[model samples]
Target: MSELGIEYQTVLGLPPVEFVHLAADLDCHHISMKVTGGGIYHHPAFSMLDDTALRQQFIAALRDRDVTISLGEGFVVRPAYELRDEAAALDVMAELGVTRVNTVTMDPDLPRSFDQFAIFTEMASDRGMTTTMEFAKSLTVTDLPTALQAVAHVGRPDFALLVDTMHAARSGNGPDDLLMLEPEWVGYIQLSDDTLAQRNPVYRDDSSDRRVPGAGEMPLVEMIAALPPVPVIGVEAPMRSLLAADTPVSECARQAVAGAREVLQAADELRETRARGCHR
Candidate 1:
């Protein structure tokens, strides 16, 4: 399945511990965990504040399954919001052996946002973690060029960019835009899709309307091919429609991973065919 990983939001509402098991069962080698939810930073259930016993259990489970906590998704960095206890979060990450944290910016002041991100990136780097900035059209750092600029401004080796397939499409970023990015600036790529209908109401529906890769109209094959070689693929299709229909999280994850695999397979085959044609 191209060793594609699953983002936590794909199976949102599943507790962190259970999510690990599901990722393992799905044969996913990597899992993204969220320490914050519903605008509340560090929800106890998933936060570092989670019971020590439970945290240990989670560690054991991860070790048993050989799954890595690839990325931690959290926050909208801005001057107005108080930064959470990053020390505590870093402690949790250390325990889990996580090396990357995802940051999204909502602040309109570019200078302020860049300054904040630089500090955040430095903090994460001090703790042996890399900070990946995720850009959405709805956010201040909207699109690949802007995101890359911010990362470059930060000028830290630990700073990188996260490109989500759905967000890239929504932001009008095409394969050409992705191709322009240097491979080193890309931390990872999130894979998901959505319908044209969902595009107009992205803010309202993005959380739940994302479709499995290859199930919607996104140019997933081209997007995947354009990304850096061997980039970690994160499946983030959070189909609330299925969840509302009482679809089990496991089933949703299975379908999401399967869809992503199909697209990757097709992309690979197409690349091989083109290479052969060129040689002939």
Candidate 2:
């Protein structure tokens, strides 16, 4: 009976107000916001975050619309200057009243130990926000080594890794991968679909590339079974078919929840099976 949510990207082209409206239409309880664009030196908000008043107004509007801030995105790991910018992004999260900040693991040009990430974690912790790092097959930390490095360096439960459906599948991470992660290192999980045919694509931003949870061939059910319990499930399907299809965003949101429902059920079954096996 875990709650389900979708990324703001799912309803692309919508501003924060419109995004919340779409979330309401879909019966979604949360929406994610991005913080990066232009360059690493730029703030995570793409200049929109510069206006503290405007950002507060948007945050209030989202609350008024009865939607929770599931997450804030667009974080990058990069050079020294970029690290400062990333820290600034965390500051914005604190001001916006968001509890979690999400970013990717690729070190665009700079490689820092998990200790460096831990620093951001402490900073966000001071502001009442948590830091969640996402791994992509395309990112440098697609394997277990990088994941371990991050968790050990941060040494905090709040600064954790993101279990992404596509990343788990494309990178061949499975039950063993789950065992490798300390429960404390798991902060958030993202659900998406990817097929064997779609597996090595160099690009992932295209709309045609995405499908609803069960609609595509991603092994989401297994991936979910392998993950530790977490607070949120963020559906991030950005298929052009969904965008161009003549359906309401609410319906798509429903579909996202439906997909997650199936995964949760499967995870429950997995636990039951494991329990039975242990007894035997």
Candidate 3:
């Protein structure tokens, strides 16, 4: 079974220290978070990269909880966003033992976008970190093929594709598409569920709100079963309704975990059944 981790968006706005503690409280061993620069939906407070005291505290929390970040996000490649500006932050995250960096491609120009991605990849690779790039409808790299193409353009073994389930569903891909993925190109998946009928008419906003795993129409089990051997799977079901209702973060996270566990267990069984059939 793949290790189940939580993404920063699983419970947004928590400070670094609190974030680690939450993971521990939930008995989750892995988490995805932005180690530095903040942007849309990112926590507004200064991260461990900026504050030495907070950094120490955050490290202590991770140590005490035996929790490590499964993925490091917050790298957005756009026309105006200088990828070089993230070098120091990258170094800090590497020092903290983070190995995988998640980047969003927003630049409309494919050549320029690939160039920026190459620069970012070089920086991340220099730090001994592997990188993954994901795309959304709102982003320039809008589909799985484009995202995969960008990774191909980078031409570094360390660069791979970050597949967000919601984005995959929204962008017209399916579990069958996942089966076609090159294992080498597969990074970890950000898992969630969504209806076939688009929830938000706006593409970007649609990803922000997702049903808990197994609770919606998303073919999560098939998707999970079809995935290559990924190092980690992040739970990223952020319910805007729950947040709007003043629901406790733990409750929301608990629901996501429960649903994810159920889905994963089912997927595992399906894999076994398939393997057995093949042997027959």
lDDT by residue (1-280, candidate 2, tens digit) is: 3467778666554556656777777677777876433222111333445766667777777778788877888766654534444666777766666799876656653246354566677777887888888776567576555776767767777888877777676667766667656678788888877574443346454323567787777767766777777777888775555545666555666676677678778877987798799999
Models 1 onward score TM values of: 0.90, 0.82, 0.94
The collision pairs in model 2 are: 35-44, 207-239, 207-240, 208-240
lDDT of 3 by residue, 99-211 (tens): 89988877777788888888998999899899898877788888888888888789989999888787787788888988898899987788888786776778657766778
The TM-score ranking, best first, is 3, 1, 2
Which lDDT value does model 2 have at 52? 65
Provide the lowest-lDDT 10-residue window in model 2: 36-45
Ten residues in sequence with the least summed lDDT for candidate 3: 36-45
- Compare the candidates by lDDT and give the number of the best one: 3
Best by TM-score: 3
lDDT score, candidate 3, position 157: 90
Candidate 2's TM-score reads: 0.82
Superposition TM-score, candidate 3 onto the true structure: 0.94
lDDT of 1 by residue, 1-280 (tens): 3468899788766767777889989889898886544221222344445567767887888899889988877756876764454667666776788889888878888888888888777777777898888988778988777887898899987888888888888788988788777878888788888864444355745646678889898899988777776446889998877877878778989999999989888877767776799899
Which of candidates 1 and 3 is the stronger one according to lDDT?
A: 3
How large an RMSD does model 2 have?
A: 4.2
> What is the alpha-carbon RMSD of candidate 3 to the true structure?
2.0
